[model samples]
Target: MFDAGLSVEEPVRGVVLLRIDRPQALNALTTASAHGMIELYTRLALRTDMRALILTGAGESAFSTGADLKERAGMDAMAARAQHMAHRLAFSIRRGFDFPVIAALNGIAHAGGAELALSSDLVLAVPHAGFALPEIRRGIMPGMGGTQALTAALGPRRAMELLLTGDALDAETALACGLVNRIVAPEALVSEALALAERIAEAPPLAVSAVTRAVRGAGQGGAEAGLALELALHQRLMASDDRLEGARAFAEKRRPVWKGE
Candidate 1:
């Protein structure tokens, strides 16, 4: 559905795998690819069967090097502005996905690519993978949630240092900075990501969605507001059929078959 720039696969039931396929360009995102991603996420949002999504690059060299500079160089100011808007829309769709989204960073994720990884709920990167926001070096600044997301993930000071210096963070440093959940070997990256997705997909869908929403709310608001949101979501989930099924299954000593209610 994403043309040649992206590809989709159902590696397991209820789990969707999305790969950025422009390895020859270090999996860089052109305008077409960005719009394709937005369209794909929009369609996926309406699918009842989608439980989790894993995003990665097609090759080991890069998750993505960010925007296709060659394409950007040829664009006028108006065209650049339009492309920026498209990228923002795509990232927003990624961050708003109801189910869990995992970023499997197999290689270098620079500039917009790093921003994309930040949008994911969880990140699993390979040992050889590295991340950076080198837009500063190119006489530009990150425009795709880079600064804000970095500040939220790392503290303001740390984020500032990286953004100002345009230095690359290795996998270990990224993990320490809380940008990634875990680091796996290159060969194990996909397997580990899929295993994590499968585990999440096995949970009750309604409860999973509630947790995702509540946690995201907490990140965006104060403690008091977050607590209120959590309570409201908990109350709402209590009335769902999946909650009843879960309780019944526990009492019967069997697995609950969730209907995503």
Candidate 2:
């Protein structure tokens, strides 16, 4: 269910914590690690009890510095192409997960790392954390969904500037650009992220999944289509036992005991 390069932990019930374990390489992902992540997320997608996920690196030096270029340097064109496909698949699996994902960026997150943070529903960074899409400096462009996610998170103009310049954005600038949601001290990063995850885990799981789908749809499609999808999901949830429990709890001034029905 897990691999040496990745560690999966449940620090709190219903909240899964995923840590990239290659701190010595600044947690840069190797091909194996990339596939490991995809497999982990795919497994989590089937779990009804998994309410939230937190992604972070094992050490304070980096959340991830992106792909392992050392490993890439030895690869032939065919190998490189395969690696690229795996990277894209990993991001796709992450984006498709039903529960919320919180990226706890403790340090540098560049190129593929930035794309990982972008795929998450929320990003929390340490004060020293930085982000960038430095693939331009490597004589290539980011091929791991970086371009589109950056354009969506920051405007096209700003995203273009960063991608072209290959400049790093510090935590403050990332927050200003809406690339990160909040900046916390390195020591507080995990705790704060876990707290947020726990909070989200308290909601009815079906409603949470529906909201995620609706918001993602709104971002990818027209308002009319997005609203239609939201309405359909809402109508489906309206008939669930959890919906009735929510109403009853509100009337009774008590917390809703969601059965995920």
Candidate 3:
């Protein structure tokens, strides 16, 4: 059910790490890669064993430069639209997944790359992992849902500034602006992401999924609604076998064996 275009591995239980492998193209989101991403997400969503996901790219140079302009070069408008749609669908699926999705940004993520990171539930970027939307300079707008996702991650004013200027925002700026959750040395990125995912996966799986969904529904409701949803999830988790084991282990001062019940 997996493809060779992208690499997938479960380095830790309940977390699937996906890496974009076309390092020659700066891991650019070609049409085939975009569709492959969508298919990968679909397959992962069906896996009961997975509780979270981490997305990254291969090589030390880039997380992704965004879409492969060279791949789209010479294609007609219709072909371009289809290609862009595939990319959009890929991001949308990642954003809407029931399980938490974390972005381990290892390098420069410009244009489409920034959009991809924005789709994740959390982003932990490397110190050299710069982010930007330089499509305006390319005489185009970000078509892969970057406009809205970027604005949602950062405020509209900042998002507009980044998009309009087509300038690069280094990891520091991205962290300061709340665009990225954390920044660490590139050498530590993969282990850090896996550790974070492992911590998340330690909790009750059902509660984790519900919390993810509830927080994502924040725009439709306020804090009260979100809290209510959290409470409901907590109640459900408390009744699960995993919660009982967690409590007994806490009292006994031993590690609990989670059943993900």
Top model number, lDDT = 1
Q: Please give each candidate's TM-score.
A: 0.96, 0.96, 0.88
The ten-residue window of minimal lDDT in model 2 covers 214-223
Instruction: Give the winner by TM-score.
Output: 1
lDDT of 1 by residue, 1-261 (tens): 558499999989889999999999999999999899888889888888888999999889999988999999999999988988888898888778789899999899999999889878899999888989999999999998899889888889989999999999999999998899999999999999999999999999888898988877766767888899999999999999998999999999999999988
Listed per candidate, the RMSD to the true structure in angstroms reads 1.2, 1.3, 2.4
TM accuracy, model 3: 0.88
Where is model 1 poorest over a 10-residue stretch in terms of lDDT?
213-222
Two-way TM-score contest, 1 vs 2, winner: 1
Candidate 3 structure quality by residue, lDDT tens digits, 2-45: 45358889888778899988788888888888888888888877
Clashes by residue pair, model 3: none
Residue 242 in candidate 2, Cα distance off native in Å: 1.3
State in Å the error of residue 226, model 1. 1.2
RMSD of 1: 1.2
Report the number of clashing residue pairs per model.
0, 0, 0
